[model samples]
Target: MAQAARRLGVQMACWKAWECDRAAPQSNRLAMMAGILAVSPSWLLSGIGAGPLELEANDRAALLQELQIASAEAVASQKRVQQIVALLGSVPVAGDSP
Candidate 1:
């Protein structure tokens, strides 16, 4: 849900509120949320359009594997970004007193 909210460009609290029926997203956000969730806006709003598919056992296993691979890749990418940021921090601008 947090990931979905981030992709939708809204705060986690807003997502939680929507989930709990305490508040609703504006029209623009509703549309974006539908896209993020891979559902039609109509279905997301009123449960009357194309909704999510139910995954079979094999499909679920494949999806889990895919998620694991993606998570590992993301961790590696974050590490690389941190290393690059650290290197950049160590480099000095021109005209500095040596």
Candidate 2:
């Protein structure tokens, strides 16, 4: 768990501090799960139960829109790279096969 947190750029000190503040560190597995999920620990530790985190409809919609935009940008970038590679291939090189 510590290694996973480190890989996620979370410091050991922060994890220890969070563990110290919790009344039942062992019982509050949700907090640990939140850390693993890369979510806000407070949302998990202070919630009604250890169930999955809930996002507001608006927030979810915004996130979906952002993902769509990112996907479109990636496709455009890939197409541009393919065009550049094709252009490069058309250029004759010294001692290259016809």
Winner by lDDT: 1
Per-residue error (Å), model 1, residue 85? 28
lDDT of 1 by residue, 13-88 (tens): 9999999999999999998898888899999878998998889999999999999999999999999999999998
Q: Each model's TM-score?
A: 0.57, 0.46
The reply for model 2, stretches above 4 Å from the true place, is 1-36, 40-53, 94-98
lDDT of each residue in 1-98, candidate 2, tens digit only: 59855754556775566568743334355455576765666755665434455789999999999999999999999999999999998999899988
Clashes of each: 0, 0
| lDDT of candidate model 1 versus the reference | 0.92
RMSD of each: 5.9, 8.8
Name the regions of candidate 1 deviating beyond 4 angstroms.
58-98
